[model samples]
Target: MSEMYKKEVPLYGDLIDLVSDVNTETLAQQPEIRQQLEHSGELTRLNMERHGAIRLGTAAELSMMRRLFAVMGMHPVGYYDLAPAGVPVHSTAFRAIETESLNRSPFRVFTSLLRLDLIADEQLRQEARAALDQRQIFTDNVIDLIERFEQQGGLTKDESQQFVKEALETFRWHDNTPVSKTLYQSLLAQHGLIADVVGFKGPHINHLTPRTLDIDTVQARMQGKGIAPKAIIEGPPKRDCPILLRQTSFKALEEAVSFQNAEGGYDTGHHSARFGEIEQRGVALTPKGRALYDKLLNQAREQLGGTPNEHNAAKYYQLLDSAFEAFPDDYQTLHDEGLAYFYYRAVDDGVDMSTAISDLDTSASQTETAKQAIADLIEQGAVRIDPIVYEDFLPVSAAGIFQSNLHDEKQSDYQGPSNQQEFEQALGAAVYDELALYQRLQSQSLELCLLALDSKA
Candidate 1:
């Protein structure tokens, strides 16, 4: 798919080249970071990691998409409602849940369901609904493959390759619109994003993001490399100990589009859809830590009086940095304060870790005494820890990127509360809680470390 996107968007190819160069330099300059990534098995996947995004126009589309992603070992994790942020959609990221699978192929997709309820114009809403109802996003071959995999528990290698070929058709861009030029303009007038979802044959992948080790460097160098970046990077400001995710993207492409006309012909038009994105992921935070992050972010935005944009980007970045100062800036502080998750391991050259543990139960890590015992192990240089890599998306950051790329003006008009139940119903399953997934991985690492140490002792 990366190759497909690169061919479709030449700038994406340049973006990939630029990111690779930046990663090599970053890994070379920061051996400690490289070593930490290697320990957590993130280094191997760093260069290959990519996440793409698509917006669905209906419940049926979203439900089938869940099934489609399942065939690739990706499941929805974390519900994200963007309506409150002004974009009329609720979303979930489809990705592999386990550590081993992520190390093997960290490709994920952020899929969103368009909220027709948020369209205040009832007539336009009904029209959009009718248009969406008439379109089919998946090929018949892909549906058969999905059912085959579900019924048989797996596909043969040949069948799997065929499945991928069929699935890719869903994400491939089509510049031809089913709606008339007038209808497309009406939807566009309501919201550019609404036009995007309602105007397409399928939820074409608008952007694909490659993982980066140093986003700040990439952001700095994008202009030098002839790419105009988004006005501001989204998410938390750069930190010594980064948490969650930071993302920036080059401007979306404006491509020629043809809309159906009144006489069963086509009318020429233009639309901006595809873009290239880059990300730098950090530790997944616990609920408490996320609250702090939310609070600080809200404080900065409220102070700015509006969403950060080109006019306010500099102030916003400074405000974001200053606000996060209250949060810890180092791993030890983050771990001690329960501000971030980490995977623990016995340092092979350090000590006899068996002597540092009185209990081997993985759940014991939650108890006060067990926590103190693990602290002792770390203090004695018997065990070392690495931050658990965050494998999910943030709502605010996601919304910001969407609006920026869609050229959708940010508005606080959509005040509807989050309806995760509705989203899950449309999805045909409940999304996994990302924090629990991270915590489970952390505990599993502790359990394995204990077993390895006891055997050594």
Candidate 2:
């Protein structure tokens, strides 16, 4: 998908090259961070495309997409309701859950299902639904292979390659659109995102995001590389200890598109949707930590009183930094306060962590005690704490990216209630809880650390 996206969006290839250079430079300058990443199995995957975003028009398409990703070892994790942020869609990121799979290939897709219910015009809603139901996003060959894999449990090497080749076509961009210019404009007026989803033959990948060690640096240098970037980066303010994810993107490209007319010819039009993005991921925070982060972020945004566009970018950033002063800036403080999850490594041969975890009780009343014991283990040099990288999406950030890249004005009042139950039903499976996944990883790493410590002792 990354290769195909690079070919489809030339700017994406440039973004990839720029990220590679920035990552190499960042690692050279911050050897300590590089060492920690290497220890945590994050180093090898840094230079590859981390994720891509695609918007689907129907539940059937979404359900099939889930199965399609399963063949590649990616499962949906975390339900994100972007409606609250004025974007009329709900989404989940599909990626490998296990550490080994992620280390091998961290590629993921942020797939969103369009909410036809959000459209106010009943007539137009029916029309959009009809259009969506009329299209099939997958190829016949890929569908056959999916069934074959389901029956056989696995595909041969040749079959696997064939499946990949056939599947890539599902996301390939087509210049000829299915909908007429009239319906496309109507959808665009409702929400640019709606038009982008319903106007195309397939849900063409909108953006390909590359993980960067220094996103701020990349943002600063993007213009120098002849890439036009959005005014502000979306997410938490920059800090010594970055939390969650920070993302910035190059402006969406305006491409010549041909809309099919009733007379069998086409009318030339243009679309502004595809872009390139870069992300800097930090430690996954505990629920308590996330609550505090959300509070601070909202406070900052409330103070700004509007969207953080180019006009108010500077002031918004200042308010953001001021608000986040309450957040812990160092990893040690984050760990000790239970503000973030950590992957533990047994670092010393002489030190023993067995004593700390032997009576570890995870009951609510003993949770703090268990945490303190782990703290003690670390203080005694028995364990090294590596921050667990946050591997999920934020609803607000996702919506912000869509709004900025889709040529839509902010609709702060356009909020939709979260319908995770409906979304899961359409998904054909329940989405994984992101926080629980991080907690499990932390616990698993601690268990390994305990075993290593016991063997040494």
Candidate 3:
């Protein structure tokens, strides 16, 4: 997929090189961070970290997408409503869920289904649906492979390679438009995003994001590398300990495309939707922490009177920083306050534990004494805790990225309602709660650490 994207968007190759250089420099400058990543088994996956985004036009496409991704060990986690943010889509990220599966290959794809119901014009909505119904995004071979895998429970080596080849065609960009130029223009007039979904042959992989250690540095260096970046970074302001996800991207490319003409020839025009994106992930926030984050974010936006843009970006960031100051910045404090999730591990020193047996008071119950000893060991740095990387997307941030990449004056006042039930009904399965998954990981780690500490006592 990267090779296909690099071929279509030449600048994507440069973006990959820039991210690689940035990662190398970051590791060199911050050896402690590198060590932490190594201990957490995340360092090995850093270089391979890549996530792609695609937009689907129908429920059938989305359901088949789920089956296709299962072949690669990816599952849908989290539900994101982009309608509230003014984009006409709801989404889920498909990727490996287990820790070991994630460590092995952390490839993810942010998939969204276009909501044709958001179109206010009744005639335009019919035309859009007609255009979408005429198209088939997946190849026949890929569908057969998906069905075979489901029945057999696994794909053979030959089948896997063939499946990959067939699946890649679904995401490949097609320059020719299925709808006529007049219909395309009508859809574009309603919403640029509508045209993007209804005008194309397939939902081409729009943007492929590479993980970065420092997004600010990458944003600062984009211009020097001849890449034009978006004005403001999306998500929280800079912090000692980052929370959720921070994202930045280069502007979408304006590619020349050919449209079907009534005269049996092709009409030449251009489309701007695909772009290059970068991300910096932080610890997954618990429900309490996420509520606090949402509260502070809304407060900042309300004070600014709008979203962050070039005119008021500085002031907006200042208010954001001040508002978030109430949130804890240290890992230990965040864990103790039950604000964030973390993976805990027991650290053993060379010293004999028998020498410290007398340190525990024998008068108290065994459970109480063991708990106190574990607390002391944690406080004394005998147990280590690492933040669990946030493996989900923020709806507001996703919309911000979408708005920035879209053509200017493409804003839509979508006052439609969010129908997650409809989305799930179309999805053929219920989406997993990301916060619950993080909580389980944190709880399991703490239980293991307590058991180890109790044995030592």
Candidate 4:
């Protein structure tokens, strides 16, 4: 997929190189961070990380997408509603669930289904549906492979390679428009996203993102390397201990396309939809921490009075920093206060048995003593706490990235409702609750650490 994307978008290869250089420099400068990533099994997967985004035109496409990703050991992890953020789609990130699978290859796809109901023009909505219905995104061979995998419970090595080849065609860019230019324009008038979904032959992978240790560095260096990055990065401001996902991207490419004309001929035009993106993930937040994050984010946005852009990005970031000062910055504080999730590991400190036993003596109850012992071990550097990497997307941040890549004037006026139920119905399965996943990971780690501490006692 990376090779296909690099071939299609030449700049993407450059972006990949830039991110690789930045990661190398980051690791050299921050050996502690490198050690943390290596200890957590993240360093190996750092360069292997790639998450692509695609807009689906129908429920069938999304349902089929779920089956397709399953062949690669990817599952839909979380639900994201972009309607509230002004993009007319709800999404789920399809990626590997198991840590081992993730370490092998953490390729994810941010798949979104177009919300046709958001189109205010009744005629345009129907026309868009008609346009979408006439096109098929997946190749016949890929569908056959998906069905075979379902029957056999897996694909053979040869079949797997063939399946990948066939699946790549689905995301490959097609220059020919499925709909006529007039119909494309009509749908474009409704929304640029709508046109991108319904006008094209297929939902080409819009952007392929590479994970970076420092997105600010990449964003700052993009221009020097002849790559134009977006004006502002999306998500939380830079922090000592980053929380959740921070993203930045280069502008979408304007590529030539042939639009069908009424006279049975084609006319040349351009479309801007695909781009290069970079991300830096932080610890997954608990529900309480997420609520606070949302509250502070809303406060900052309300104060700014508009979407973050060049004009107010500095002031917005300042306000965001001030608002988030209330949130804890240290990993220990975040974990202790139950604001964030972390994986706890028992470390052999080589301390004397007498010292370990002496630290356990307390006036508290038996359970309290155990808790205190564990806390003391952590404080005394006998236990290590690693923040669980956030494996989900932020709706607002996703929408912000979408909006920035799209044409500035092409704003949607559709103030419609969000229907997660409808999205699930279309998906043919319920989306996983990301918070629950994080909670389970955190709880399991703590339980293991407690058991280790009990044995020590």
Clashing pairs counted in every model: 0, 0, 0, 0
- Across residues 245-301, which tens digit of lDDT does each residue of candidate 4 receive? 999999989999999888888988888889899999998999889998999999998
- State which candidate has the highest TM-score: 1
Estimate candidate 2's RMSD in Å.
1.6
lDDT for 117 (candidate 2): 90
Which scores better on TM-score, 2 or 3?
A: 2
Total backbone collisions, model 1: 0
Q: lDDT tens digits, residues 36-101, model 3?
A: 789778999998899999999999999999999999999999999898787889999998887888
Where in model 2 is the C-alpha error above 4 Å?
352-366
TM-score (all chains, Cα) for each model: 0.98, 0.97, 0.94, 0.94
- What is the C-alpha local distance difference test score of each model? 0.90, 0.88, 0.87, 0.85
Per-residue alpha-carbon lDDT of model 1 for 203-256, expressed as tens digits? Answer: 888888988989999999999999999998999999888899999999889999
Candidate 1 clashing pairs? none
Candidate number with the higher lDDT (3 or 4)? 3
The model with the greater lDDT, 1 or 3, is: 1
Positional deviation of 37 in candidate 2, in angstroms? 0.8
Per-residue lDDT, model 4, residue 418, is 71
Show pairs that collide, candidate 3.
Answer: none
Candidate 3, residue 328: how far the Cα is off, in Å: 1.4
